[model samples]
Target: MTKMIFLNLPVKDLATATAFYEAIGCVKNEQFSNENASSMVWSETITFQLLQHGYYQTFTTKPTADAHATSGMLIALSRDSREEVDAMVEAAARSGGQADVREPQDLGFMYLRSFADPDGHDFEPAYMDMGSVG
Candidate 1:
């Protein structure tokens, strides 16, 4: 079996978070989703599990970090081109997500833009041109 990644995140509102992800091109996997949690498919090998804060706490004893209060983690997704990266940022803003979390970065062969979901989880959409790399 191929190894897959499941990134679990705590959310204040499952529906809103799920919708935010959907609006930005992720598809929900109903097979692994429920009222308190959603399995958002980012790629064939990557699934992001958005769990309601209380539901998420059941998974571990550690306190759930308040993403809005402090930096938790940054989730980066790859795009096909620089335009795609910019488009995703636009989509995120239209879907009630916030951009300007960090300044957009362009490094000739790579481009990145950051946004925060309604729950304040950071996501960076990036594009890289391997052909342009020296």
Candidate 2:
């Protein structure tokens, strides 16, 4: 069986969050989406579950942290090339997200850029040359 990952996020506005995910190349899985939540497929094995704050609370007793003020995690996505990393960031910025929350990093073999969604969920899109890694 193939292992799949589901990233569940608490969002203030479901519609806005859903649109932002779609702008960044995720396709909506209507079979799993509804008014309070949206299932966004990033890849065959990766899906993002965007839930309204109230709905999200039902799944956890912990109070939702304000992503704009505090970051609990950073989601990293691998890209095929440096250009792809830049493009993702660009798409995010154009779609109600912030691009380059921090300075981009470039090593001899790896390149990475960071961004945040409208609610400030952080993401790092990176590219690495396998041949250059030693």
Candidate 1 residue pairs that clash = none
Model 1 TM-score (2 dp) = 0.96
Question: Across residues 43-94, which tens digit of lDDT does each residue of candidate 1 receive?
Answer: 8999999999999999999999988889967989999998899999998999
Best by lDDT: 2
lDDT of 1: 0.92
Q: Give the Cα RMSD of candidate 1.
A: 0.9
Point to the candidate with the largest TM-score. Answer: 2
The weakest ten consecutive residues by lDDT in model 1 span 66-75
Q: Candidate 2: what lDDT?
A: 0.97
Off by over 4 Å in 2: none
- On residues 1-134, what C-alpha lDDT tens digit does candidate 2 reach at each position? 99999999999999999999999989999999999899999999999999999999999989999999998999999999999999999999999999999999999799999999989999999999999999
